[model samples]
Structure formats: structure tokens, C-alpha cells
Target chain A: MRLFHGQRAWVLQRLTALVVLLLLALTAATLLIGPAPSYERWHALATSAPGAVLIVIFFAALCGHAWVGVRDIVLDYIQPTALRLPLLALIAFILIAITLRVTLTMATHFTVGA
Target chain B: MPAPPRAAPKFLNLAQIRFPIGAIASIGHRISGVLLLISLPFLVLALERSLRSEADYAALGTWLNSPWRALLLVVMVWAATHHLLAGVRHMLMDIGIGSRLAQARMSAWSTIVAALLIALLAAMRWLS
Candidate 1:
């Protein structure tokens, strides 16, 4: 089928959204269902096959979705070309920073400990 | 007759009757997404604190109970609920369940109702 650029973006956004929603629910449940684990236990859960996978997926989807949605918001509300572009860039940088910080810390923690 | 009968006007109450539900929902969706994104690091920090030790967890509870944290949680819930209601609307549209003009309008109203309900629930939880 012939799909427009916006349509493709819309599909990706929705799929990412579903992933985020499910992951958020799971994360909240995990946090609430069990007693708060120690740093070692928490680290183990996070770096385990399932937890690590979920975190990676959640971060990836969240960053992409937030970047696109926030970019559009800035474009729509902020009329200035120079300011708009820079703010959009800032949002992109924020997403990348979040991904990198979480990933690197998780990686280091897992590798050093495990 | 004074003149040929004029056609009925389109708007009964243009400003009040007409609403851009999709646009409103879309904007809210985006706003919530951004809020969740920006607030995430602090929550993560709180998690880290809570994981360190029991005293640290108690301190985290104290920090979380502050007015600032309350406000932040309120924002989070608001964003989460809005996104959720709008998401259901999208799902219905994708399934071709609300394609008709009448159905679409009703669906829009449903979105609004859902959003308000969510906000009210969030406020109750936050205030309590």
C-alpha cells in the first residue's frame, strides 16, 4: 500500500507508544509487587536477560517517540526559525543523552559485576 | 414575499459548538510524552536512592512527600492518563470502528470525557 511519510511516522509512533505503555505498566508492577530490593538485587534484575531487554526497548521507543512528538510541538508553537530549530536540536540531544547515560551505566554495572 | 428564502446558515454557535478534538488530543498526547521524558531522570534518581539502603529509602520517601514531588507526580499522572485516553481513540480509528462523521464526533467526545475523568482521578490520588 502507498503510505505517506506522515503515515509511516504515525505508525512508528503508535507502535512505540504501545511498547512504552506495556513497559511502564510492567515496571510499575515490578516495583510495587515486591519489597524494594538492595542495590545488588536491583542490579541483577536490571542486567538480567529480561530486565535488560525491557529497559533497552523501553528507552529506545521512549526516546524516539518523545523526540518526534516534542519536535512537532516546538515547531507548532514556536514560530521563530532559528529558535525553533535550536530547541528541536536540544530535544534531540536530551534524548541521546538519556539513552547514552542509562545504557553506559547499565553496561558498566553489568560487565564489572557479572 | 420580501425576498427569495435564504439558505440556512451553517453555524449555530461556531465558537461553542465546533471543537477540534483530534488536535486537542494530539497536543495533550505530545505534552504528556514530553513531561514524562523530562521528569524521568529525577524518578530514576529516586529509585537509585531507594535501592541504596533502608535509610536512603526512608530519605527518598521524605523527599517524595514534599510539595515539589507531589506536584511532579500530579503532572506525571496527568500526562499518563491523557496519553492513555487518546491512545484508545487512535486504536478505534485504526480498526475502522469510528470512521463515520457521527461516530467520529462521538469518539472525540469520548476522548474528552476520558481525559477529564483521568485528570480528576489523578488529582484525587495526588491530593490524598
Candidate 2:
């Protein structure tokens, strides 16, 4: 029996890619079409419910998408299982830390009038 | 029967290979993905700093004024644009939209052109 089948991974990668695409477009529009990057405008946007939701979704999808892509590259090039496992773990740790930091920052800083 | 002669090992010469446009675009996708991954920490730090306060935001703005920071921002803009365009192409291919050889090549070229144009615009906006 095969230990790993790539079909599910491929499908999930595409799904997360789609999410990232939409969210990235939304973000670019917000930054470019809206007001210049100022604290007040940015704060207002980040504090709003919709803005916060979009940001959360964007970061989550981005993390998922990056993880899949990075894992593929690491597997392709890294020969030694020992080295590869450690590198993958390190990358996963970094991505998870970033996701947590962004989520926590958004949750705490963008609260209802701080 | 005598044992078959061992096949001669062929070494890959990186400088001699000619990669097609589609291959270049595909490689760019991976390169940009890696770049974005590595830059995430710095990007997040900047985002957090800018959101801290008006003073912090202003300081972040000042930080962008340095030539090196400006250059890094340009590279990031290029990476983002290239990755976005290449990703869309990959998605379309997945959906059987542009999987044909001619169509794939066209999309690859378009991705490069569009990404560069967008990156140029971003560079101008950020620098000037």
C-alpha cells in the first residue's frame, strides 16, 4: 500500500491557491484604490469586521499555500531523509509562528476601540 | 549472455541548457514562492510595526526611504506580481483552460509581460 498519495495534496493546494488569489486581489485593491497608507486609514480598515475577516482568511490561506509549495520543493531537492525532515519541520514552525503572530496581533490590536 | 555495458553517466550543464518560456515561468513561480516565504517574517514585522501607532508607521515609512529597503521592496513587488500571474496560469491549466502547448506558451509569455508591467508600476508608485 502506498503511504502517501499526492492527489489530495494537489487538490488542496489548488483550493488554497484560489483562496489566496481572491484575497490577494482584494488586498491589492484595498491598498491601491483606497487612501494612501496612513495609520488612521489602515487602522480603520483593520479594525472593521469585514477587513479583519478578510485579513484572517488571507493569512490562513497564504500559510497553507506556501506550506504545500515549499514542501514540494524541499522533497524534490533534499535527498537525505534526516536533513529533509528537519528542514521541513523548521519551515513549518516558521510558517506557524507567522500565522499565529498575525492572528494574535489582529485580534488584540484591532479590537473594538482600544 | 554477457552483462550489458553500464550506461555512461550524463552530467547536466546548467549554463548550456536553454529553458523555454513556459519552463522559465514555472521556475519563476517556485523562485518567487521561496522568496515570499523567506520574506514573510520581515513583511510581518513591518505590518506589525506600522499598525502599532502613528509614530511607528511614520518610522516604517522612513525606513522605506533607504535605497536598500527601496530595492528590496521592488524585488518583492516583482516577486508578488510574477507569482500572481504564474499562479493564475497554473490554475487555468488545472481547469483545462490553457493546457494546450500553444496556449500554455502564450500564457507563460503573458505572465512575464504582465508581471513586469505591474512591478514597474508598483516600483514607480513606491519610489516616487
Q: TM-score: which candidate is best?
A: 2
The regions of model 2 sitting more than 4 angstroms off are A1-5, B1-8, B124-128
* Candidate 1 docking quality: incorrect, acceptable, medium or high: acceptable
Candidate 1 lDDT over residue span B18-113, tens digit each: 557666667677777677777767755664554456588567656646667776677677777777777777777888988777877777777767
TM-score values for chain B across all models: 0.66, 0.86
Residues B1-128 of candidate 2 have per-residue lDDT tens digits of: 88657985677996799999999998889999999988888878887887788999888877877777787888888898899889888988888999999999999999998888887887787777
What DockQ values do the models have?
0.35, 0.84
Tens-digit per-residue lDDT, A1-114, candidate 1: 632256666778788888988898887787657776555566577776677667767887888777667766776789988898777777778788877766765554454334
Docking class of 2: high
TM-score of 1: 0.73
lDDT for each of the candidates?
0.71, 0.84
- Which candidate leads the pack in lDDT? 2
For model 2, report DockQ.
Answer: 0.84
Interface RMSD, all models, one decimal each?
Answer: 3.2, 1.0
